[model samples]
Every structure is written in C-alpha cells, then in structure tokens.
Target: MNPDDFSRVRSLWTHCGLPSRPNGRDSEQHIRRELSDNTASFLVAVDPDETLIGTVFATHDGRKGWINRLAVDPRWRRRGVAQALVAVAEAELRRNGIEIIGCLIEDGNDASEQLFVTLGYSRHDDIHYFTKRDRPDI
Candidate 1:
C-alpha cells in the first residue's frame, strides 16, 4: 500500500479498539524497503477510493515464512480482505521456495485460528507457544 494509506490503517485499528505498536523508527522507509526486498511483504485492502480496510505482514527468515500482525478494519470485516492477504503472502512464500508458512495465533482468537485451518494449515501438537526475553536469572 501507499504511504497515504497509513491513516486509514491506523483508523481501522483504532476503530477495532486496538492500539498498534508504532512502526518503530523511519517506518515509511522501512516499509518501502521491505516491499522492494526479499525479506518482507505486506498486503492491504483498499476501498474504491483507495482507503485501506485491512493489512497483514509476512517475513522470510531464510528457512520458513511467518505471518504476523494481521488485522482487518472492523468496519470492513467479513469482506474477504484478510483472506486475500493470506493468499498473497502464501503465494509469495511458495515462490521463494518456502515449504510451509507458519502463523502464531493466540489460542483464543477463533477467527484467525479458523482462517488458517481453512487455508490448509494444520496446528502441530506437542508444541506450545512459550516466550523468553533477553533478561536472565529469576
């Protein structure tokens, strides 16, 4: 999406009652670089007037592809924008020779969980999501 679409994306998230973390330093340039490079890709859904209604980000880590921070504008929900984004990301990953795409969805987020399943993703058992920060010593 174009730089002008950030306002729409921001508004969409706000309308969804979610506070997005700031893009963290030189956001526009970073996004442009990502879209131009092999490292990352993002998709956005825009209305007839080019106002954004949804967005998702994907990254290639030299081994597998990962999708994260997917969101759809609440006002524009259930219109297939999110689905399209996922499709595009998967296609790109496949093109890059990525054998599989993995997404980490919070356990209670039914919609996301279902979307991945519907898209042919299966959740692997025996692997639970755990986090560890840089700090050590309890």
Candidate 2:
C-alpha cells in the first residue's frame, strides 16, 4: 500500500495481533522507503466504503516469494477477505516470476495454519525459522 495508508494499516495490524511499531521496520518512513525500493509490496484490501479490511506484505529475494504480516479485521474474519488477499498477493508474486511462495505462522496460530493448508500450501514441520535482528522490536 502507499504511505498514505500507513495509519490505518498500522491500526489493522494491531487489531489483528500482528507486529508493528513506533520504532521498528513497520514505521511509515520505513514502509515508504520499501515502497520506493520496489522489492516488496504492502497490499491492502478495502471495502466499498474504503475501510481497510485486510493486509499482506509480499516480497521476494529474486527466488522464493514470501508472504508476511497478513492481517484481517476481526469483523471480516471467516469471510473471504483473507483468501482474497492471499490470492491477490500470490498473483502479484507470480507476475514477478516467483515460483514458490511461503509464509511463517507462529506457534498457536492454528487458524492461520489451517487457512494456508486450505489454500494448498504444504505444512512443513521440518525446518526452523531463524532471525538475527539488531533489536527485538524490529
């Protein structure tokens, strides 16, 4: 999404229990920079009234594509909003020539896991996700 959508996007993230911050990678400035860089896209789904109902961050490292920070408004959950978001994001990644798309679901998010599985993603319990961030907040 554009920088103009940052505030509502951040609110949606928080409402959906996704990570966002005043000090981390999700800042409007950082999002603006990433948008300008064009390596990633912060996509949002809005309703007829233009109220944002979902969001997903799609990015790729010239190989596998990644879907991250997916969030759907609680009011919209169990509807098709999340599936639509993922579909659009996957289409965008495919347009960029990405063949394999993946996402990480933290422990205890059974709903997300189920959603991905329903969307045709295989469940892999064989690998671990490792991250080395300079700070925890980021």
Candidate 3:
C-alpha cells in the first residue's frame, strides 16, 4: 500500500467505523516503504476504475509465515475479494519457502477465524499463544 492508496482505504475504514489510518506520517511512510521493498508483500483490491477497496499484508521469515493485515471494504464484502487476497498472499508466501501460514486475529473475530479455518488452518490445540504486550492489566 502506498500513500496514494489511503484515500480508498480510508473510505472503507471510516465507513466501517474502524480506525484505518496509520497512527502517524512516519508510521505510514514506514509501512509503504516496507511494502515497496517486499520486506512484506501488500496486496490491494481495486475496482475496474482502479479505486482501492481492500488490502492484505503478509511477511515471511523464510520459515514461518505471518499475515498481519487483512481488511475488506464494506462496499466490496461478500464478493470474494478477501478470499482472493488470501489465496494470492498464501501462494506468494509459500513460494518464499515458508510452510506454516498463520494470522493473529482477535479471539472475537469469528469471521476471520472462520476464514482461516475454511482455508485449511486449524487452531492449534497443542500449543498456546501468549502475548507480552496484550495482557489485560497492561
């Protein structure tokens, strides 16, 4: 995603009442730079007129693959944009030699969890996910 892509994504973000804009100019620039440099691969869904509608971001450590961002525009939901983006992202990540692909989603995001499960990812029962920063008292 580039600076120019914000307007399209912003509309989706605002319309969905989600905080879509990056926190700061520097932060925004950093993300775009990373995307352009392929430190991560960022994909955007655009309309026939070229208006951005949705986006996803993924990273690979040449080992484990992680997806950090995935959002679909309200106007484009139910049309398979999110699924297509995931498909492309997974293929690209796998091509990079990563085997396991995982996305960290809020426990309450049933939709996203469902999406991942339907794509053949099963929640690990053998391991627990712990976070250092998200502790409730933090």
Ranking by TM-score: 2, 3, 1
> Looking at candidate 3, what is the lDDT of residue 121?
84
Clash number by candidate, in order:
0, 1, 0
Of the pair 1 and 2, which is ahead by TM-score?
2
| lDDT ranking from best candidate downward | 2, 1, 3
Residue 79's lDDT in candidate 3: 83
lDDT digits (tens) for residues 1-138 of candidate 3: 666775666566566554343554224566667766654787788889887777887788777888766888777887888899999988889888878888876658888888888888888767778756532332
Q: Which stretches of candidate 3 lie over 4 Å from their true place?
A: 17-21, 24-26, 131-138
- What TM-score does prediction 2 earn? 0.94
TM-score of each: 0.78, 0.94, 0.78
Clashes of 1: 0
Tell me the tens digit of each residue's lDDT in model 1 across 48-138. 9877777777788879999866788777778888888888888878888888789887667898888889888998877988867443321
Model 1: lDDT of residue 1? 60
Q: What Cα-based lDDT does every candidate model obtain?
A: 0.74, 0.88, 0.73
CA lDDT, candidate 1, residue 56: 76
